[model samples]
Target: MAAENQTQVTEFLLLSFHGQPFLFILFLLIYLATLLENSAILALVSLDPHLHSPMYFFLSHLSCLDLCYSSVTVPKILANSLRPQATISYSGCLAQMFFLMWCAGTECALLALMAYDRYAAICQPLRYAHLMRRGLCVAAAASCWLWGMLDSALHTLLASRLSFCGAARLQHIFCDVPPLLRAACSDTRPSRLALHAASLFVGLSPFLTVLASYLRILLAVLRMPTATSRRKAFSTCAAHLVVVALYFVTANLNYNRSSSGAWPVVDTLVSALYCVLTPMLNPLIYSLRNQEVRGALRKVVGAQGTLRLHS
Candidate 1:
């Protein structure tokens, strides 16, 4: 009982964008809206059969990833908004780090899968069916989880070696690797190297994959016979392109830099967009833009109303 009690770290301290009093309400609105919109998208995708496709398969997973990614930081920030002081236990911090990395890594792989799906659809329409079959979709989604798990496992291992001997305060909003390393009490060279390697493997690799896939997609789109077909394909790629750009910009800034603090607020805001709004907008951007998704949504709503009336 004593050992167990001693081992259980109670809470963690969160540093907001910058101890800002005015930002709370704005952040609250953003978090609330993101949750609402992302939730609706996920519900609609699951309920509407017509929305089932390689695109939606990827979209649904992205919705889920957004839910998770946003969840890591926002609730705590909201709580801090309501309270004057915010704190978290060591265990809670560890859990947050694990889960956040898990979701982020998964998003990396999932995005790559989405790009591949687009590549297949645009570059090889005749064989898209055989290529992106139900089994393949499931396997691709499973691979995302596996990759995330692998990332989290290695990170956790590296983090355990760190000792919390210095200032307990974490500067960032969440328990990110660099900030966490700054707080560690003991040597963290191994952990830092491990994190860098993981970044290259889990983060940079996906960016390259998406880039190559999009390059091919663009070439394929250009070769299309009709203007309408080109427009439709570009539209499909547009939202993803915007979202991916947002993620890579913020993420690369946050990670790729060795040391910099030119604009923390701007960085925080961009990070929040990738972590929060991107996830929120993914389903809406994709589903609303596509006619098939809207048709599916209508059918689902109609079916539900009919069922309720009959009942």
Candidate 2:
């Protein structure tokens, strides 16, 4: 009887915020803004000589990750809002989960790298250049990318082995490990263990690294002789600190909740904040808080205006 009742599910119904026109328009606007902001950051970091430091190098990568991260989920959310029945194919869902985890893990590691960059610049000025040399920076960034890919590959592999016996409707907004595990009928112990392991290493470990880096930075800043130096040091770290707080707080809320119950509205809002809204906010935070980025933006705009006049 159990065998007879078992049915294969080829598509998952994404019922969260389905057929909501207001949300469709809102997400469309947010997606466009996210693209514009991240693209501008990439252009500024690449073209502007002033942003050639280790800080903006990591910032550019952060913007890239934000772009990929938002693209993975927001487009689908916008499409689902317009459709009567929002659905994703089995393969599509797995692919989404893969890239989503990839970007999330990469961003976590990248943020930690950015913190260390600041710490080196502030706490060890004498060794800053040697500590963050070009080759080492490139290698470190590459390692972070590799770390994220390997972590995502393991979780995606585990998730693919899950067997869904009946309806496979994910309770949350998008394809993610938690909801997928919830929907599976097979033994989820391995997947759950993998998730717990990732939560520790990929998520919590990076956060702890960031915390430690900033703590050292704080002590160094306090030891500085001049107020101006202290202020300048704090200014350099302000944007990254805000971004770290925003990303980790939302991530923990989204992933670290108790697994026993469901709150559809809260879950959807938190997911949207983490996946949709945060990307749009990151560049804004950087540009507003960091004078270098704003100066670069002005230079780029002025150059464009001059080119138009010359033409």
Candidate 3:
């Protein structure tokens, strides 16, 4: 195929795993549950004054990100699963990639900021108030959002320039970075280099920050005089740690595994896990594992009950 005459792809087909009715129903339920759970957390945090700490502030943003992150791709997947041939327009694919990348980068930075918040609260309780003021928290969160959007914009700009002369069938459920690069007929080394650099910035850098925060947290916990204090300190960090581990582990596994050549099932499963299941699990980890979130939830429920009774 001549470089100048190669056919430009207007759309691409997403190949899913068999597209069973049961699978579609299952994914639909999971997606709906993710939306409801994350939305509820956001609402509760917004409405409850007692939950207005830096921690819950980050949690609320985390919920919002997860809700949006899942929304960027899951509904499309659910809709696609029911179709005879799952297809997405060129613009739609680019939009999906952009939004997903933005959400992903934002969440990575947000998680690091959340870790620092925990570290400040636990390791430096006396100065926690000074360290994590409203202005600082808002600035941090805003930086995460802005940086993520910038990263996504750059990625989309580069990716949109690539030519596609071969089959337009994507071997995964969504328009992920790796598969899209693979489908490109043009040389993707520049794009791949840019992507790797972005990953290092948005992904690995934050991961290392989280690790350092946890290390400091551990040293602080070890120095505590009482077991009760140690347990309390550790408890505050446990949920975030679980989330970080799940996210980094799955993400590293998915992306670090050969970008072009791999078993499709393994790739698809890993992609689904970090992309779909992680969002669903995040709110659950926060709400179920944190007492303040539980109390806030109960208060919200109780308020609703009282309003219903009065009505």
- Preferred candidate (TM-score higher): 1 or 2: 2
Off by over 4 Å in 3: 1-7, 259-261
- Per-residue alpha-carbon lDDT of model 2 for 1-311, expressed as tens digits? 33333236688887656656677788889999999999999999999998999889888998999999999998887777778777899899999999999998998999899889888997889999999999999999999999999999999999888878767788877898888888888788998888778889999999999999998998988888999988887776666677778788878777777742287678777778877888898888755457889988889999999999999
For model 1, residues 81-190, the per-residue Cα lDDT tens digits are 56656677787788888888888889888888888888888788999999999998999899998999889878877775666643366666767776777666667788
Tell me which residue pairs clash in candidate 3.
none
Q: Give each model a TM-score.
A: 0.88, 0.93, 0.94
> For residues 123-216, could you state the per-residue lDDT of candidate 3 as single tens digits?
8999999999999999999999999999999888888878887668787789977888888878788788888787788889999999999999
Deviation in Å, model 2, residue 288 alpha carbon: 4.6
lDDT of each: 0.76, 0.85, 0.84
- Number of clashing pairs per prediction, in order: 8, 0, 0
Give the winner by TM-score: 1 or 3: 3
Q: How far off is residue 257 in model 3, in Å?
A: 2.0
Q: Which residue runs does candidate 2 get wrong by more than 4 Å?
A: 1-7, 225-239
